[model samples]
Target: MTAALDAIDRAIVVATQDGLPLVDRPYHEVARQVGISPDEVMNRMDRLLHEGAIRRIGVVPNHYALGYRFNGMTVWDVADEHIAEAGKRVGDLDFVSHCYHRPRHLPDWPYSLFAMIHAKEKAQADSLAERIACVLGDLSRGHLVLFSSRILKKTGLRL
Candidate 1:
């Protein structure tokens, strides 16, 4: 099913995604910039969320700034039948900020469930992954843990 988004809706999304205004009246500020009433901006935002155009709306804190400098991408070779269950379980963990299934790319590696874990240090991140593996069961075909040594860029969606 497709939901049509009018110009105003598009504008609201584009503007907000760039970074919502930081002020006492952020909605009003955004509305003024978009040439719409504050009510209109709010209505559009509600509609967007209801229609699933926007899954969620909130601030994205910088993990590094929060002293969570160690980040890692963990890959697990979960069975096809258990991928959904395992993914959901892993996604629910607080340490796992991102989790999803992706097609396997070989001959170097083959893993289905990909998850990103951030922690104060490498050992902590690795420990979290190990815990997740234990919870998901050790029957997985294989698993790989990769730590991030650098961050190239971190930004919101570009519309």
Candidate 2:
């Protein structure tokens, strides 16, 4: 399990919940907000990753603003035993921004693999989904594409 975050650590998370600054010294900016040194911010982030408090620290560009108008959360129904392998293959695709295995919901929802695809339009997103299907091959029993009409709430992990 991840370690409990101290006050400073929690402050860091709160300050960065929206995102890090766009300036060259984003960490320094975060440090400035958290009332700590830049090195301390780096050390805390390193510890967060090391202790499983955070998986990674990186940039998240505004996809829609960048003309990536279509984003699809593609779900797949795959054999539970083979989902791990299939998900890895899906995750490796250049078009797949993110992919992972998830628990199934039985009757109404049976997807075991979820992959996020970004494209400029719906056709392109669907094409990428087709490519994913080709990659999953016989392992996938079925699939569905869920679209997002607008941004709801976007945030990384919180303490």
Tens digit of lDDT per residue, candidate 2, span 16-82? 7777888899999999999999999989989987997776777677788899988889999999899
The global C-alpha lDDT for each of the candidates, from Candidate 1 onward, is: 0.84, 0.89
TM-score of candidate 2 against the unseen true structure: 0.83
Q: Candidate 2: which stretches are off by over 4 Å? A: 1-7, 156-159
Cα-based lDDT at residue 13, candidate 1: 80
Alpha carbon lDDT at 145, candidate 1: 85
For each candidate in turn, the TM-score is 0.83, 0.83
Q: Residue by residue across 29-125, what tens digits does model 1's lDDT show? A: 9899889999989988887888888778787777788998888899999877888899988889887888999987777667989999888977888
